[model samples]
Target: MWRRRTLPAVVALLGVSGLGLITVGVTADPARPPRPPVDAPTRTHPAPDLAPLPRAAPVRVQIPAIGVRAEVVPVGADAAGVLEVPPLDRPTLAGWYRHGVSPGETGNAVVVGHVDSPAGPAVFFDLGRLRAGQEIQITRADARVTTFTVDGVRSYPKEHFPTTLVYGPSDIAGLRLITCGGRFDAGTGNYVDNIVVFATRTA
Candidate 1:
């Protein structure tokens, strides 16, 4: 569970801003087919001998391919026990799971951001465009820059989110970038799918 203070702050900001519920998904669109479950086998870096770094808080994340460069903010579960996201007002800022292992550590590090806000497409709007073998960089407080190589990208319905597969512990440093995707459902005011990018630390 996360501290309670942030929830009220988020609610206060969102209530005044009129930003609707920010859950992941895309409404029905004629051009694109419905999103399919991603069952791609996980791929690791060839250099398994490399060691992970000591735990350190992540300050920022950069993905050159999709032009994502955002500040990292710590977040935990909200009052409803759901993972909290960065405020819609600050869509460009990504939220890191404070309870999870930090990026570059020997475990899965989760980062989440909004796909869009009422104003326009947000920081992670282009996250689904990333392909395997692309690079993701994390700048840490210790001044060490860790680079991760994308293993694969997956999209799953919110109803059947793969909790274990995404949040499971790993022997090597791993990273997961999550955002909204698929067709939007205006009636529900939510997207129909979640886009997840998996990567392993390379340096």
Candidate 2:
């Protein structure tokens, strides 16, 4: 969980999340999706212009503590800020959360990853094992890499996610990870809990 005694200078960042888990369906639901948390931070840069990252496949993902080393890819969002996840063709591995908040200027940045897919597993399968003070490295489009340190991990019921804690405000550069968890509700086809990991930029 993230705690900010006060808000600090913000920075460039975005939120990533998978949609609520669901059972394989023979039909589609027509209702609009839920609104993202209103407290999410927003990026103010003009050049990126909310453009999509090149479709180039990711080369690697690094976590110094739990031995996570995998490739990643760029996911985009609609006007609402809800982002897309991995496997553009498959719904299981995809995650999107635009309203949660961006890493406003120079504080904690939030991104959500997926745990598994109906086909098998996904990017954040081991997220539950992450601890405080670990390292996270992301290689960006320019080939420049960014590093962050894990502070802690927390799980919350989706219905009771800590809006203030996840998107409220912060005084330092950080990261928050989210994925589905808890009892599987076969009825609605969703997890009751959301795993959240807090990370901080180190370099």
Candidate 3:
């Protein structure tokens, strides 16, 4: 039977299989505080009056500020009920939670990628560098390009990861880009924080 575990625990479990390379330490710091949260603003510009897509899956995601352009793959929960991430081997790929709303739909669409891999920096390596007003573009299977403007970027301790806020329902189309960031815990082999970019659809 599947068991419920904190996101960090699940990440640690996955780390055992090398996926933790996303948060593994490149440099060590033992003086890091036990609870650290990086919170970004939640302000957004007015959205354009564009018609929403009719349930088509996203094909690609592009973030110009960070130079990330990659194919999007659908992912679901694993046998243990933990959310599955993209394979470590294909570090350039991004995964969209299959159970969530599609990018152009009227809800929160989540896309997650690794900040780095064992080989080096990955697709979302610079995700935390994104600033408010940055653009995030997603191409749908129907050939429509949906654009989202960054509202803010925040990093929260994994233990206090705001699952509901990140995955919550939205009246308008929204997008969330997630990756590991903040201080790396060499002892645990995982990042102490999760960097989240909140954006709202503009076109």
Candidate 4:
């Protein structure tokens, strides 16, 4: 398991791993310049915030900006309170933090995925490429689709991940998408940082 982000530390969202799976050679592009540290407010509203939708588990997620369309599976924290990632072998699936509010609801809903696997780039490999004004669509079990407008994308060193800001309570419907990034550590078989995308329900 990766460094534990216990329930207490992150409040309701539980754990998140900067290292999703052990990769063979895929890593962050060393040539790409690093992004400035993220200091944005906890919630961002590009358009008027949409009212909270009824409780409905997300079934699918589509990020057209990065061409990511994947099945969404509910995953809870393990006994050690570490947030669980999708099985390494199933790299195309994204794991939703089932314990938190569902997408389009009134609080933060989180989804996590691997940037890569032993085979190659995974579902969220291009997550870091997303930018503000882009949109993320989540299809729920109730057949309702909630669209969110990207507020920002930030890469944080694992050690400095803002637990409350990323996973904390929100006044309006919010969404968080997470994956690993930064330099790859050959010794640890993980990345040195995490990429987080923040958005608010726009429709």
lDDT of 4 by residue, 1-203 (tens): 23244556343333234343424344443232234245553435455735678999999999998889999999876665667778888989998888788998898898988778766788888887877778999999999999988888888777777678667778888889888878777676677777888888889
lDDT of 4 at 180: 82
Note the residue pairs that clash in candidate 1: 25-191, 25-192, 26-182, 26-183, 26-184, 26-191, 26-192, 27-183, 27-184, 27-185
Per-model C-alpha lDDT, please? 0.73, 0.48, 0.73, 0.75
lDDT of 1 by residue, 29-85 (tens): 323222323567368456366677888889999999978889999977655446678
Arrange candidates, best TM-score first. Answer: 4, 3, 1, 2
> What are the per-residue Cα lDDT tens digits for candidate 3 across 1-203?
22234434444443233234454444444232222125555766886776767898888999888788899999766655456778878889998877778998988888888776666677787887788889999999999999999988887767666666677667889898877766766777777677778899998
Better of 1 and 4 by lDDT: 4
TM-score of 3: 0.82
Worst 10 residues of 1 by lDDT: 11-20
Over the full model, what C-alpha lDDT does candidate 2 score relative to the true structure? 0.48
Per-residue lDDT of model 2, residues 117-196, tens digit only? 55444566567676665677755445656666666666666666655666655655455666665555556655556777
Scored by TM-score, the top model is: 4
Cα lDDT, model 1, residue 39: 60
Candidate number with the higher lDDT (2 or 4): 4
Q: Which candidate number would show the highest lDDT if scored against the true structure?
A: 4
Worst 10 residues of 3 by lDDT: 28-37
TM for every model, in the order presented, reads 0.81, 0.60, 0.82, 0.84
TM-score, prediction 4: 0.84
